[model samples]
Target: MIEENSLHPETLAITSGRPRNTPDGSINSTISLSSTFHAGGVVGYGRYGNETWTDLESAIAALEGGPTLAFSSGMAAISAVFSILPVGAVVTASNQGYSGVMTLLHTLQASGKIEVRSVDVSNSDEVLAVLPGTALLWLESPTNPTLAIADLPRLISAAKDAGCGVAVDNTFATPLGQKPLVMGADIVVHSVTKYLAGHSDVILGSVTTKDPALFSRLEDARKIGGAIPGPFEAWLALRGIRTFPIRFEKAQANALEIASRLSRHPKVDQVFYSGLASDKFHERASSFMAGFGAVLSFTLHSGVAEAEKVCESSKIITHATSLGGVESLWERRRKWSGESQLVSETLIRLSLGCENVEDLWSDIEQALGNA
Candidate 1:
């Protein structure tokens, strides 16, 4: 095998964590389905570990430049991180982050287990103001739905100076786009269900950390909490990751094209995408990431009713919720009850896929025209 560390991310995605030659010289790693192993072994029980899960974790860890632990779902991985916090811990998070994360924080706050403070992570001053005495600073750069980019380096630096740990949700910008550990984040989280498992068939999550202690704690939490991914899901995720590089590249290209068109459309009030030259976060994003990612949002001039009409009128694009699949998806953000109030009713979040740019544009244009 080649030295994966010296190679680029696109190369690493194809080559890393592959099994050595088996007895029959099989290229893919075998999925071990044993529930219990012999006593006194490294993996005594299935809940604790699996060969398939280990292979998947190793592959993702190689990409993230750290050790990784896999979980049943993205929320489970996030819950594992929060499980490490002591009762009454103070956590500062993005005000307009993923709705699921915000709901979890609110639930914990309601139970009095943790105190959550929400802030605009893009504002360096606001982030710095909340960092003092904070146990953890949770970040989601190029935030979901809104596509607002956070000043990660600045926030990470200030958090470190204040003796706080920083965790970045790297699902939007996969390790191929940005390496949070290299940029000084203490932990990086991913929804493997998204880009990592590009087919949208598997539901899994992972967390990677450079710190050995943090990795151990998260692993322990996964084991004790029984939030482990099945062998099949791990195997599927590993398979999906093999083509991530090319899929991401194509999707990002499509997204940039779509965003450019949307910005000039008469029906569009505003387009939010870091990839655009006119975007406020364009410079910062260019400085930090390999690409601006495949997701973008735009507000319709005709408002919420028209947004709904456009979503229904689409022929090629799927009107769905989650993103980062091989097929394009778009939805009105406010359609989800849990979506942030900051996300305007007219805003439609688009998740570009590996579709032809002209075909996608025609579908969108027709939908907009009909609306």
Candidate 2:
């Protein structure tokens, strides 16, 4: 057997979780596509385990450096993390992050299930102040929409010292750009619906952990909550992982170029990309991350109306929700009512894709002009 650590992640992305020396000469694992097995082995039912989900999970675990479990959606994986906490547990999370996560946290708080502490994750001191009684410290670096970077090492260390579990949403950074587990996070979650799949075609989520107890707990949560992914979707995501490295390379390159150009554009007030030296979080992000991520956000001088117009006017970039597709996508952040008020109403979030940089920029220029 090949040692996972001895191989590069790019090579692992293509080669991990594959069947070894099959007599049928098949390279890819086929979808099991059954609800029940023959009742003779460890996995008796599809919901408990499937070779397809296992293959996808194994590939992600290879990148994340841990055991992983796939969920029906990113939110499902997040919910499983919360499930680990005891009733009435105190949870601290980013004040501004993925709206779905924020919404779920607030909903739980409203139901008197968990006490919520919202803090600026970029500020270590602010985060630490509320950690004493917290059960979990949830972090999202290059945070959703606004792209604020966090000091993961400092926060994770403090959380551990305080006896709090640490969970990081690595959806934005992806496993390739950053590894929170290596930084000592207890758990890492991803909305595989985004970058890992590399196309907008599938919806999936994952939870990874180096701790066997935590992994077993989360695996039970997955099985009990019935948050398993479809066999076909898992197969599609595994197919997508084969090209994850190359796709991310092209996307990040386009992001750097587009963010630079957008920063210089007259109509743009500010660009929020950690890749740009002018960005506030650039230094922090560069200190730990392998690369600045592919997503960037910018605010328009003309406000929300113009932001909406820019999204609508784009020809090449799709005006849509969800990201990390082969084609570029952009959206007005505050259009969703649940979105954090901390995010500027005029902010337009861009998900850079593997499209030609010049073409993407031309689309942006035309959109800005029309707006």
Candidate 3:
């Protein structure tokens, strides 16, 4: 086996999960559709394991520098992490992030399984105050919709000192952007349905960690809970990962330019992208991550009605909810009732794709004009 640190991330993305290249062997991994293996292999049952899933997990683990577990969806992977927490665990989480995660925490709190304490993750002092009794310090640096960035290294260190396990939602900042494990986080989770799959063709999630015990517990949860991904989805995700590095690089470049232009637009009141020098989190994100990422949020001079019009007016940019697809997409985040009330009703999230920069800008300009 090659040492994890021996190769660059770009090389690892290309070579990590390939099949042997012998004379007759396949160059790529095959989808093993069988539900059962013969007598006594490590994978005795289909629900327990699959070769395709293993290939996908191996690729993701290499990128994140840890062992990994694949799940049916992003929510399933997050649920697995919560499943391992002790009953009545006290959890500190970001006040603004993916609505799905916030909703899950709310449900768990209502069920009395865990006590949820929400805080502005960007404020280090505020987050540290609640760390004393927190079982898990859940974070999302460059938080969803609002794009609020947290000081990850400081928060991770403080959480560890407070005897809390730190789990970072690394979806917005992919492994290409930053490796949270290297910064001392205990666990890193991803909505692989986003950037990892690249094409937006599959729905999958993954959890990665350096801790073998946590990996084992999550594995057991996957087996018992039956939140495992199918062979086809795993295969598709792995295929997408092969081209991830190149795709992400192009998209990120597009986003940086777009954020710069949007900041100067007449209709734009605010642009929440760390790539811009004027953004509140620019310096922090510059120090914490390799790239500013491909997704951005902005608000118009008008209110929610104008934001909705911008989304509806886009021609090249699809008006959709999910981010991180090769085809550009945008939406008014607060249109969904499940979205946090703290998010401004006029904010629009734009997910950059591998499209020509001028085309994207022209589309945005027209949309803004139409709105």
List candidate 2 segments past 4 Å from native.
Answer: none
List the candidates' TM-scores in order.
0.98, 0.98, 0.98
Measured with C-alpha atoms, the lDDT of residue 22 in candidate 2 is 63
Score candidate 3 by TM-score against the native. 0.98
| Each candidate structure's count of clashing pairs | 0, 0, 0
| lDDT (Cα, 0-100) at 136 in candidate 2 | 92
**lDDT of candidate 1 over 1-371, digit per residue (tens):** 85767888777777776788668776887787899999988879999999899989988988899989999999999999998999999999988999999999999999999999999888888889878879999999879989998988878887888999999999999887888899899999999999998988999999999999998999899989999999999999999999999999999999999999999999999999999999999999998888999999999889788999999999999999899999999999989888899889999999999999999999999999999
> In model 2, where is the ten-residue run with the lowest total lDDT?
17-26
lDDT of 1: 0.92
Q: How many backbone clashes does candidate 3 have?
A: 0
| Model 3 / residue 350 / CA error / Å | 0.3
Compared with the true structure, all predictions reach lDDT values of 0.92, 0.93, 0.93
* Model 3 spans > 4 angstroms off: 1-4
The regions of model 1 sitting more than 4 angstroms off are none
Residue-level error in angstroms, candidate 3, position 264: 0.4
Candidate 3, poorest ten consecutive residues by summed lDDT: 2-11
Put down candidate 3 lDDT per residue, 1-371, tens digits, no spaces. 97767987888888877777899899898998999999877889999999899999999999999999999999999999998999899989988889999999999999999999999999999999999999999998779989898999899998998889999999988998988999999999999999999888899999999998998999999999999999999999999998888999999999999999999999999999998999999999998799989999998899888899999999999999898989999999998888999998899999999999999999999999997
